[model samples]
Target: MKHSRILSRATAALALAGAAGTAAAHPGHAASLADGLTHPFLGLDHLLAMVAVGLWSARALPAQQRWQGPAVFVAALLAAALASLGGVSLPGVELSIAASVVLCGALVAGAREIPARAGLALVGATALFHGLAHGAEAPMGGFGGFAAFALGFTASTAALHLAGLWLAARLQRLPALAWSFIGAAVGTGGLALLAARL
Candidate 1:
């Protein structure tokens, strides 16, 4: 019953986000709080990577350390976004973000094989690129506007991660092979997006 409720909520959230409109590669559609909240949903790469982080966390880490993955990712994401505001830059942001999807998905698929700390590190590192991409694309604004956007973005991102974690929990009933297949699918999707960008 609890599992069903969690799944239902996650599905509802994804459905609502999917209804938000077309997904694009950082078109800078709008810089408002709404945009920040919805921006991660607007991009396939961001959505996949964020969710995969949660999935990987739940799959690989012990229950006690599960929060570390999301914490590291969110911190890195915010740091990179803030750094970009200060004129810091990372080359090939789009490519890296795409790669994050692929790598994160792969991690989910093979969560048992990798060490927990290594997985956490990879998540944090890739998040930097995501942060840079989001930061770079966001329009210039005063501190107030940026702060609002950041708050919304951060909240939305954490929600997505929770969704992934919930999904992982629900999937525990499934065979390991099934979980691996899902991860492979996500990785394949990332590859397709990467090819499009390249």
Candidate 2:
């Protein structure tokens, strides 16, 4: 019960912050850099996979391993950017993004603790697909606007990971059913993304 309350409060706080961020990003325009930044957050597959990175990171190692998670993700983002600049033709990028959710969720559900290097490699590879999709999809515009949007999106990703960490911490005390539910939801989101791709 206590854990549930904490989760609820944390979720509420994130929602409020996300709303504020959205408003700041776009005041009148139906679409803007903020929207671009938020595109991933609006999708369950993206949200779950990003959060799962943090959750799995937490479960895999001690607090000292914190940097590993974000570092790997950033590296993946860089790879994706490079791929976009090179005009790499990656087929089924969306499917890969969705599959990331299922893969990461299953890792967490199984409580698998991979080696640090191996884990980072896995995350980096997955991030490539995500980053490429975003890069390819971004509207051509001013570099300044693009930079801002990217920063906002990155910040949002971090926020989501924080939320996931908080939830994971609380869920740790609960029965396995709660964690399994999270995995199921993430996997379902992956399937939805896959179907959309079809």
Candidate 3:
């Protein structure tokens, strides 16, 4: 029942963000890796999911296994970016990326820990979708710049995850509830981003 409620809310939220721009939307009227570097910051869906990767990693795995989750996500992200560069296309990339935000946030809020292998699979799968979405949005005729953008976004994503991981680690030390609440906030923010589209 609880899962259903969260799913519905997440679904509703994705529906909202669904209407937002479907593309990565960058390097227009300018050409630089800097633009690509800042692209993820341009959208809430991307931003939340990237950071949630970090948060989910911290909460879902043991200390030694934490880095594994982000690693898988990033590797897959790079592959997807390459695929996009090669002119590959996938349907519903935007919606899937948004759904990742919902799922990652939910995982954090629930404090559901799982095996490292399983966690890596989960984050990796979602990351492929995200990579493809970002790749698809790369500026045409600017592989060098787009590569920079890819590097930019990938680096940004890692930083976001690190931020999440660090905060959660600190929060886990406190008696007060912190990480769980932040997860809820992340989920809630995702919903708003989705809704803002409508």
Candidate 4:
């Protein structure tokens, strides 16, 4: 429990540092940089999905398996970056991202005890979609600014994952139905985003 708390605090601090870096990188467009940095956090569909990654990781494995979760996440980020650089055209990326939130949340709520390798596979696949979206949407002209934004966003993601870990630890005590409701909420938000796009 103490370890979890420490991790959570560290994640939050990293998030703040990433945001600061982004701000520093774009001095003339502080507002823009802030907005860019926050773009990933604003939408419920996005935030929930990212958090769900962590939650799913925690619930799907023992404490010893924790490292795989972050590793898969980083791998996904790298894959997405590569895809973006390669100019892959993913038409429904935003909607797919929204759906990932729902899917990952459901996986967590179900408390599925997947093998570490399977969990990594699932996360890596999802990361590709997310990474592509992030890469495609990145600003073209300001590499420094974009780098800062990416750093902040990545930090925020890690923090949310930590939060998810904390939440999952607590939720383990709750009824399964209650957990299902959490999944339903996440799914509902994703569906709403999908609806909006359509």
TM-score of each: 0.86, 0.75, 0.76, 0.74
- Against the true structure, candidate 3 has what lDDT? 0.68
Global lDDT scores for all candidate models: 0.79, 0.63, 0.68, 0.62
Candidate 2: Cα lDDT at 31: 31
Task: Output the lDDT of residue 13, model 4.
Answer: 39
Ranking 2 against 3 by lDDT, winner: 3
lDDT of 1 by residue, 1-198 (tens): 664565456445543433343355588635778878988877888888899899889988999999999999999999998898778997788887878888987898899999988898999998999888777766676667777778878998999899889888876765577667667766776776777678
Candidate 1 to truth, TM: 0.86
Runs of candidate 3 with Cα error greater than 4 angstroms are: 1-30, 174-179, 196-198
Deviation of model 1 at 110, angstroms:
1.0
Write out the backbone clash pairs for model 2: none
- Encode model 2's per-residue lDDT on 1-198: one tens digit a residue: 887675456444433332222111112222356765676566665676788787767666577776577668866775675566457758877678767866776666555445766777777787887777666654455455556656666777777777667667666675555555555555655665566556
**Model 4, poorest ten-residue lDDT window?**
22-31
Ten contiguous residues minimizing lDDT sum, candidate 3 = 21-30
Instruction: Please write out the lDDT profile of model 3 over residues 1-198, one tens digit for every residue.
Output: 554454446434434443443443332432457766777777767767777787778777878878987788889998998898798988777666667776777767655645557667778888898788777777677678677777788788888779768756644543224445556666766565545443
**TM accuracy, model 2:** 0.75
